[model samples]
Every structure is written in structure tokens, then in C-alpha cells.
Target: MNIVFVMIPIAILFVIIAGVVFFWAIRSEQFEDLDRQGSNILFDEDLPAHQPNKHTDHDPQP
Candidate 1:
């Protein structure tokens, strides 16, 4: 029917636009290092633990 004629071109246009955006992302390196960002929060830097001050160190026995 008349609706089919309108719908077909709209669908084709949508596909073309999606393809262009996908290619643009690839060329721009948008997908590079995807895992690094996702896992960055999971692990922390291997910093040395803070030690207690000698003056504040206390041993108590009653």
C-alpha cells in the first residue's frame, strides 16, 4: 500500500545513518581500551600501608 512506500525509504535511511556513525566511531578509536576503563575501578594502586606513629604506639596489660 501507500504506507509501504514511505516505510521502506525511512528504513533504508535509518540503516545508512547507523552505518555512518559506526564507521565514524571506529575511525575515531572509540572502542580502543574499552576494558581498561571498565576494570580501572576494580583494582587500586599498590601503595604501601600507613604505619602507626611510634609516639602513639601503646601496649596495655592489666
Candidate 2:
């Protein structure tokens, strides 16, 4: 029961720290690229499939 005194102040401090960091990030434009990130996944890509070379059928030692 006495520990609540210590925990309550700690929790309040945590909330204040989190709010400050959030406001700092917002003021610095950290969320500006959020819309671009959502749209980037909709574009088509020309990537190729990865595969190993098939050299088992051809004999180079014989």
C-alpha cells in the first residue's frame, strides 16, 4: 500500500516524458513521409526470382 506513493509519481513522470517526446517528434516533421510509405507499396516491381544453378545433370569430370 505504501508503494503506491512511489509508483504514482513514477507513472506521472513516464506520462510526461512520453508526451514531451511525442510533441518533439511531431514538431520535427517525423510524420511527413507517412503518406508516401502507404503509397509506395502499391507500385509494380520487376524483380526476378532467385534460384541456384542446375549443373548436376551436366558432367564436367567425365
Candidate 3:
């Protein structure tokens, strides 16, 4: 079909754009520390449940 001529160029342009974005991500350090970022959410840096609250549940009359 004549439409193939149009679609082939569009597909090539998409591939080129994807490659550029991939390279940019690599150069910008976007792929680094992927595991650490995921693990940060899994592990709690500070445990508020174990820490005592500054204010008590009941307040004394002023």
C-alpha cells in the first residue's frame, strides 16, 4: 500500500527518538542506584513506633 511509505519513516523516527532518550538517561545517571532506591522504601531509617512521644496522651490542667 502507498501508506507504507509514510509509516516506515514514522517508525524510523520513533526508533531514533527512543535511542536518544535511552542514551540521555544513561549519561545523566538515571540508571544508577536502582536497587538502593527501591530498598530505601522497604527499610525504615527511623522507627517512630519505638520512640517515646514528647507529649503524653492526657494533658494536666493548666
**Per-model TM-score versus the true fold:** 0.63, 0.62, 0.66
lDDT of 1 by residue, 1-62 (tens): 99999999999999999999999999999999899988987886776688777678656657
Clashing pairs in 1: none
TM-score of candidate 3 relative to the true fold: 0.66
Assess each prediction's global lDDT (C-alpha) against the native: 0.90, 0.86, 0.88
Clash number for each model = 0, 0, 0
Q: What digit string (tens of lDDT, one per residue) describes model 2 on residues 1-62?
A: 99999999999999999999999999999987898878777874666665656775555765
Ranking by TM-score: 3, 1, 2
Off by over 4 Å in 2: 42-49, 53-62
Question: What is the Cα-based TM-score of model 1?
Answer: 0.63
Give the alpha carbon lDDT tens digit for every residue of 12-35 in model 3: 999999999999999999998789
